[model samples]
Target: MEIVTTIRREVLTLPAAHLGPDNPLPPLRPLDETHRVEDRDKEDLPRDMARQIDYAPLHSLLPVRVRDGYDRRREPRPIDTLVIENDRLRVTVLPGLGGRIGSLVHRPTGRELLYRNPVFQPANFALNGAWFSGGIEWNIGATGHTALSCSPVHAARVPAPDGGRMLRLWEWERLRDLPFQVDLWLPEGSDFLYVGVRIRNPHEKPVPTYWWSNIAVPEDCRVLAPAEEAWQFGYERRLRRVPVPVHDGTDRTYPRNSTYAADYFYEVPERRRRWIAALDADGRGLVQTSTDELGGRKLFVWGRGPGGRRWQEWLTEPGTGGYCEIQAGLARTQLEHVRLEAGGEVSWMEAYGPFDARPDGEWTGVLRAAEDRLEAVLPRADVDAARTAWQPYADTEPGERLATGSGWGALEVLRAGWKLPGTPFDESTLGEEQQPWLHLLRAGSLPEPPDSRPPGGTLVARHWRDQLETAPATPLTEYHLGVAQWHAGDRAQAVRSWERGLRHAPVRWPVLRCLAVADQEARHPERAAERYAQAFDDLGRVRREAGDDDGSWTAVTAALGREAVEALLAVGRTGDARSVWQRLDPATRERGRFRLIEAGLLLAEGRREEARAVFDAGFEVADLREGDEVIGRLWGALTDEPLPEHHDFRMRPTP
Candidate 1:
């Protein structure tokens, strides 16, 4: 018998590129000027002191390159792909496109464990704008698809510690200035692929980060996991935790026949081990497992209704089938819950493999069989203990409630063959899945709204005003109206609109944020500080109410607090800034960006030596070659000697 492990590179040509002038990519906004507000204070200080003060540009912290629409083409291009294979499995990775797993197949049956898109389709679905729907996307840095998702990453083939071959993909996360690496290893004679991940914050200041492994599979697949409860955003945009598998009289484990779409974030139970699987009717599927570090799982399903079908077709090539996502996150939910201290790093390992079931066995049986096989190959300590702990839950009777929390109890109900509540036109009534196209068409008979008037500055604003006047009173519409008013230079009206929206919907974070921005722009520092504080408080309540005790609210609260501190500083209220800074949680204060503010506060307090020390420590971890001019200014202040503006202070440049 022989064992083989090889990796090779190839260029994949996608079929007839969807090229047309109508398919334009979204534009990237310029960096915000307010981010450099601290620099404006330089003029107020004495010449010697001003020259000594360091003013770090926002770019130093977030060195993101925004590619314009012109840089993107919908035409054919030779995409670089990495193919790694062994005796049992083959995995293809697209190093240039987010280092996504383009394909994962079981060799013996030629069964694809992941959904592969025939074309490289980019759509404006991500928070940073461009997103593609297929395979496995490694999300890092701040949430969504991450800024690196549409860009190429560093790739190399290296020897693993165990003397096995490994393919490593890495990149510097622009927003947080953090470095992340993913290693894929296929051990000899093993049927599973081992993925090792590491994220490091080498900078002197702490940074908030997020990580999620989004795996796409065929639509309508049954998902099996041990989560007790799931959190979802309701119609009002509030996060709420509900029973898993079945929530609010609906089955969420699989795609529903309704018109509504569902997106769930599951809170995995506290355990030493965890696993989630998506199986087809034949009980053949993919299983993802990891030890305690990775705990959150998410599911997103697009219904087969008219709007859902339209979005599906618009997002991908016409002939390609629809798919859903099974995501695994490092924290309870998202990066908002994770904070990495300066020079800190976190690492974890996960395994993916295929499993089969006997003709007479259920999906659970297949999962157990796979678990048994994994126990034999992987490290045994934690896995064995977890299996022993989970035996009672697995063996519980159908519909029997367990003493565990809502999340675990829900999983037990799912294990008992619970069916989704039936609808009026369900398969039972129609003898097949019934299409609601006619009903939908009638309901959506209203004509589309006309385009806004030509952009003469105020024209767009007037359009939004008209929308606010006639449209239903919703937080989203009011927020848009406030935005348009602000853009039209009607700051007072924008503030009023935002405040009204806030009063009506206190949970709307964006409205509060917009109000704060309006106040700041209008030079009302006190009002801005108040609004920012309110927003922070609202975020905390939302997270706590949704049971997100794991710091999933980190990003929002951090942003609000930072803005409050800046607003206070802008008004020369150093004492107030210090007070707000002190009130911030340790995790938020530990971030590298916050450390800069702390150093500034110390400088304001005339603690020159302490401030200098802080700056010196920051330089040790910061990358000088990345054009960190601020550090140079700080060093000059401490030494009383002017340093070159663009000198490389590091001993060696980053590779």
Candidate 2:
């Protein structure tokens, strides 16, 4: 059979909600995530394992803005896709969406090897914000979903090791200021798709880096990997080493066996083959194998719980089949980050193909048969050789640009004057967002923001922080400086900087809002409420003075107003919360999130039926968090009415 591979561009239309602009405010607020796995499980682990589990998480997303602007309303939107295929298989990549491989098709069998979503519903899941389920997402540079998940990445055709065209997706991750590239192609007559990933650190110092390739597979399949033990981390905030395949008399390898969402990180021995497969009862499904560099394999199951099922529906249409994630990462678990040294780089190759093994009888036999079949068909040596052959092409300059990504990388290149090979973040990609920073680079000072709104943007990279420290000590400068300090984990100094800015800020609300969040994080509820009230008042005055240029200003007012009401409610300031709510734009008041807030206020005012009435209207909090049970708790407070399916997103066992 002649093997002719081809790559081309196409359009895929889906019902996708626009990923509205990011929130203007920097994320200075405290994170309420459960403590890392080691907090409760440290006593029983090896020293190194425990230490790895204790990796620090970011307190805030300072430089990168929070993406809370998107709403739940969606319509059919045309999405750009790159299709690469051989005679045997086809892969569809959504380059505009973090280069996510949206589909993997076994052409001969006419079966989709991945859990392809029928629609694109943006949710509050990514590290920076706005994430969707399904497809293979390239999780890079952080513990959570990549910020680039909903954003575009530079995509272009590159020379493939097999003398064909490979689709290369490259992007600059803002959080850690790192550049990474992913090269994907299909070899001649090969059953598997080859993916080569490389992350490089151009800085003069070390940087904490994380990488995970997340593949969404059908939930009904039984997951298998080469391991006898695994580390389980659940929303319950506890980590324990459980037996592979089965634990507590439950065969967890099947997604339906568990009652809540959880992650199982397989403890594959260093010398074992690196692979994982999700196969049906007949033992045929997608198998992912990678070179030794990508050692960790994980299974994330949205189990048989009400919340899990509800989330499945929320991410897709009502009747779409559910999916589970089988992941490969650079560390032992997603909880850890590998420190890539200065001038260092990490690269690896992974293959995704169909694995067929029908080893009945015993679990051990099944594992043995699967391993033997995988090694025989596609040995580890071939993957290593693929990586070796792909290296030269990985450095080849991209040709015929297929898509464009954020201008952050180009701005960095211009500012630092660093040269990168293979992946080009061209200067032509710079946009309006980079203008002020470019001015800061050219002129030693940043221009003051026109209005009181958080300066058009804020950059918290170390160099930018250094520049802020040396620039004029203006209110705007101090406000930005505080954000950088907070991102660096110096809460006290950050508060001092914000307060210093507040002393002389002409408008006062910008820095005051930052101070309000600082107080909230410090757990001074009363102070937080008071500060929020003051900040809201100042902002309201500005909003009134500005009048109506467009509807955007009103929207900003509503956004801040919502935050103010929440703060006021936390401290028993019912009247103040009501006042804030009343001041919100009439249209904003109708949003599902606002309706929920209204329900909260009604409950606080002892109007239980009114609160229940709000829920009876049936609303969806577009930004509701994964583990937040606020809606259920609110329902209980109102009446004993059964919790609505749309409102149940509880990820853990009820306390």
Candidate 3:
């Protein structure tokens, strides 16, 4: 297979097209009026001496672009197979559309597209500057040494053989007018667009390159992620949901209000490389932000004002709005590079668009359903203890406890040859074998104390309901709930519960173990991270309370610690998480459990080298035996990729 990559460049000049009615970007304002005096002082100093000065004009240093006009309805010959248009825009498809050179974000807009390079702007300064002083400024400016080019363009579209496919080049008047489009196509659908640009990289070493979709949202918007807790700046309603230590060592609390305009970045440090973010699209979009590979990857969100502040107050600013950035690398962090032996190709793509939260569940439901069915076969004895423990609080809102029962019930129904009572879940949509028995569990929110038992038995159901009520309500509880929710097809609810659990009780051991399981099911990682942190705290506390000489806690603590590290990997926070795991007590570290956890996390992060190291280390404890169920779930959570064909099940041996 052929690979494609985009070289990154810095925007040195501002384009005029971005100054239209919708995008009114303000110029970079100087910190002090005597800007010329400072410039002169630096002009005469030694090159090295002058470089030491932290000199950054938040607006001036930022690359600005303005594109005039661009059409999506036309393109050049031979490549054109068809032309299609709606009242809004046109599309063209060429031979290379699906090949390497395809444009990831290309579409026509009514007005111009001008945005200041956020990577080089004030937000970057505020977040990175406080600690490094000028160090952050210098690193950012130094890396931003790239040339800027602009093209004036107008609209056009080219067609492909398939009705949904199209390819073509558009005319541009300036940088801001570069067109972008979001096309949702059925299988076998295609579309393509081409535009011209000038790019340059200044580093001695060829640095990897990537771009971000600078999208603007209207005043009213709501955001959600699968994370239990999130990084908080000065956003509105920032509260410390999860007590994970902040990188800066400050308090770990989030704001209380829900409205905010500052940039909040979340890092997803796992290997699956899948992500989902959504906003309430019913109202005018209420967000704006940048996506640059230079910053850490994952997701970076910006809104009108601080959480709880009115949109009008925030949006009225000259260049203030909400935004969600899609970066080629981790969000809020710098780009990472992998050194190839000799010949190397580094390719990336940046994308951003309006999304309906409802549809995301529809798209990924197949895998989710399969996972749900897989767990349904376990006997109640395996999970019944957890259920029995929480039944007292069953009167309370099930909170997340609802999910554990749901997941278990789903598995039970499937093993018993049951199915959802609806048309979509029938044999046609999901073959009889794949049909989920849990769908027939309930109609509304999980009823409290109401007799809703699956076909097999009530002991397991009773156990789950009991634990749902009186449990410490920690991360583990949330994780189990999230798993249940996921299996029951309450996708959004499952994610929300997991995030909430992690936020409030991150140090709980159960949460970390379950977070890994839940995130794997959801195809995301942040929640798993929250769970990992809680697990670490839980195991650490146990060790401390047991005293240094306690060997049992040492082994158990190391085991839990390793599991936490694995959870971090499950959610894509391997680098830092691994560092934390490695620092455990030496005795605990000797047990191969840590290595196994490390291997699992590395595998999740796609670090085969690191994973292999841990996998090899596992041989030291090769003779150790684990309960069959633990081994099965551990394997399932770690290698959902090419899932293991047969697990060592107590129920039966494979022929």
Q: Residue 72, candidate 3: how far off, in angstroms?
A: 30
Top-TM-score structure, candidate number: 2
Candidate lDDT values, in order: 0.57, 0.86, 0.30
Q: Candidate 3, residue 591: CA error in Å?
A: 71
Each model's TM-score? 0.52, 0.96, 0.26
* lDDT for each residue of candidate 2 in 529-593, tens digit (9 for 90 to 100): 88888988888888777665666576557667888899999999999999989888887898888
Q: Model 2 RMSD to the real structure? A: 1.8
Clashing pairs in 2: none
- Runs in model 2 lying further than 4 Å from the true structure: 1-3, 450-453, 640-642
lDDT tens readout by residue for model 3, 1-655: 2212111211222111121111111111211111122344445543432333323222222122111111111222222122333322232222111111211221234311212122111111111111100000101112111111111111122222233222222211111111112121111211112111111221123323323222222222333322323333332222121322232443211221223333343433332222333334331111111112223322333332322132221112225443333222222322212221222222222222222233123223522432233224222232233233222222121111100001222333333343212100112223221222232233211322112111111112222433433544545445545554443446577667767876775244544554555565565567656755765666566456546562434434444465557656655676767676776877555544455555666666677677655543442222122112344455555554532222232212211
